[model samples]
Target: MTTAVAAPFRFFSLRVVRTRRLGPSLVRVTFAGADLAHFHSHGHDQSLSLFLPAQGRTEPVVPIELGDGWWQGWRELPDDVRAVMRSYTLRALRRNPDEIDIDFALHGIGPGAATPPGPASRWAARARAGDPVVLLGPAVADNRAIRFRPPEDTDLVLVWGDETAVPAATAILEALPAGTRARAWLEVPHAGDVQDVAAGPDVEITWLTGGRGALAEIRAARLPRCERPYVWIAGESGRVRELRRHFVQERGTDRRRVTFVGYWRRGLTEEQLRAAGE
Candidate 1:
């Protein structure tokens, strides 16, 4: 078996300063602490790992010394005592206040209300000012989690995702160079989940509301003609793979120009999914 290499990211103990409902099924959590000054966000589709406190706990249990052995150390912790880890995208980063904003989709409050709470979602829903959590993030701005990289000569950008991918898509949109052409399709749980997106004047966003199959909709929708269109997609694993196929096969787009991320699977928990990959 090939052991996964330990990540070089730094760990920070951040406290939730505030939380607010961004839309029907989105919560924006603002975290701040002295350690945030070391956090460097690359801006586009940047992902972070949050080590959340276990259920009924107030503070996350994290290692005091984190380095090459951190991954093994965390894995060796007893199951019941280990903090729950989850990945999230950075929505916004502010330097003056030394804060980072993360948006969480309220997966527990809607159609899946009766389902057991996901560790991260549950923590985010109940998160309040002063609540502490530990984050594994970048000390340098160019760390690898920011995956939305379009080629320099690309003519246009195509973006798509479900609610879980919205923050990243929006961030990618906002980070585009001024006047760059782009089109995005965001799938949310409801119409109310749509928020104002900041993008260049040439960018257009289409929000896909309830029951709209994002992959099917994108397949049938008319895309603006472009000689070199870079595509970025993230969401359910199956759909993302299918979308990737469509872009590279049916659409005949260059394989290198399309980036697809399977953020989650429908029936599997994040831990299960990660184990399958390992």
Candidate 2:
């Protein structure tokens, strides 16, 4: 299945209340607003669509005012006025304060740099307190985009991801029940990108720096014996596919029990990737 399933999505205007660096390449932006009170998110790998404005613009130009056919209306807009849309995981949600936290991975200009400049990365780098943006997310708590649902009879959980998928994987780790057995492999561009993650007692996490030999590393690692293991993997498109193959073919995992998603592709912008249906 795709990374995000259909849900009743509504636009919420969120203003950045705070921003901080979580690591060498990660920035945590906290948002709050009255409209956020209607924002309900189910925590395990819950995804949201962020609409960012053009450089120098204060807010995204969302044509949601057009009608229920907002997506079509957005496409009809002039290029300069249309917002830049990107999908991100809901890192943390606090209902009492009407706030949400999202972790952005900055690439190209800092430690663990990779690309030249990206729309989301540029916006994140320049975002400050009080900056406003729009998000398309669930209006209710139970939504299909929250895709960390393991079978009720699951015995073990296996997860893998690169830096881009860290926040979602972290959320999944946090949601695992106590005494649940889980093993996670995370790949980041630099050693400093690895942050401490809190999870259940039986969770074992391995962090790989630079992601140079991550495929080989995971292939060499052995999974714990379990009758019904639910596996999740996400990251760069090529690597994600390779790891999915490792699980399905090499490890003999049932394809139906594995959930794999390609968060991004190396050499393509979100626009290009989406256009090509990657």
Candidate 3:
């Protein structure tokens, strides 16, 4: 029996042992290591920092010399640049030999904000198994954040989010009490993006598209919700925040019952939103 080790900084360094493309927009990386054996699973809304290779395979530094000025450039990067860590959620974890699965939503490919090198972005493009990486959290999400909690008893849970936010929502639904009422709205970018998401019963799942009509179409008809039901929602800040206010203020639902969180703000990166959330 391996005793649990208190992780330093609530984060652990693990190696990517396997990679499976779950969907067109999702990459599931299975992480394993003794360090991760004691990994704490707080909730589905877990936010973790993932460090990709500092350099890509094409330009990977040889001889592995760190203090020889090769790493100086990155070390001296500005705050915004230095804070390039990617924020992700834990999709699943197992403790036999200790393993966890993290889902990464691949939105797009772009050059680094301050450099054209795009080491991290490009690194993700070709990421594979057996690569060593760093994971920096299991930090408990804010209780106020939407869908982060499961009530003892309740009405149906209403969860909604785009591809980027669905991982957290789906994980929450999986942890809900059996037979709990629940409903979900998944805004997948592509039809293929809705590959294998599973949630508990009492959930009316709806998938939307960005190219279609605005969410107002959905919200307008949802003027009324079931009784004693807590609505757990997350997505773009604009949409999730709107529904949050609607349920709490407009519809007169108790604030404590509903968990509303804007996982990502529009026109902002996950890192930025996480930083601001801090």
**CA lDDT, every model vs. true structure:** 0.84, 0.83, 0.61
Tell me how candidate 2 scores on lDDT.
0.83
Poorly placed runs, candidate 2 (over 4 Å): 1-7, 112-114
Candidate 1 residue-wise lDDT, 1-278, digit = tens:
11223444678888899998877778999999998877776757888988888766666776647556767788888777788988899999998889999999878775535566687777788889999888888877887887888999999899988899998999899889997899888999878889898788999998998768776777787887789999999988888888899999999999999999988999888899888982
Where's the lowest-lDDT run of ten residues in candidate 3? 56-65
Steric collisions counted per model: 0, 0, 4
Cα lDDT of model 3 by residue, 154-247, tens digit: 6667666676677787787777777777767777656666755565556567777544433564556463356676777776778877877877
Of the pair 2 and 3, which is ahead by lDDT? 2
Best by TM-score: 2
lDDT of 2 by residue, 1-278 (tens): 01122356678877899998877778889999888777777757888889999666677887766547678888777887888899898888886778898988887756635568688888898788988788889877878777777888999999998878999999899888889999999887777778888898899999987656667887888788899999999888898889889889998889999988888888888889878876
For TM-score, candidate 1 versus 2, the one ahead is: 2
Native-referenced Cα lDDT, model 3: 0.61
Clashing pairs in 1: none
TM-score of 3: 0.75
Measured with C-alpha atoms, the lDDT of residue 22 in candidate 2 is 75
Pairs in clash, predicted candidate 2:
none
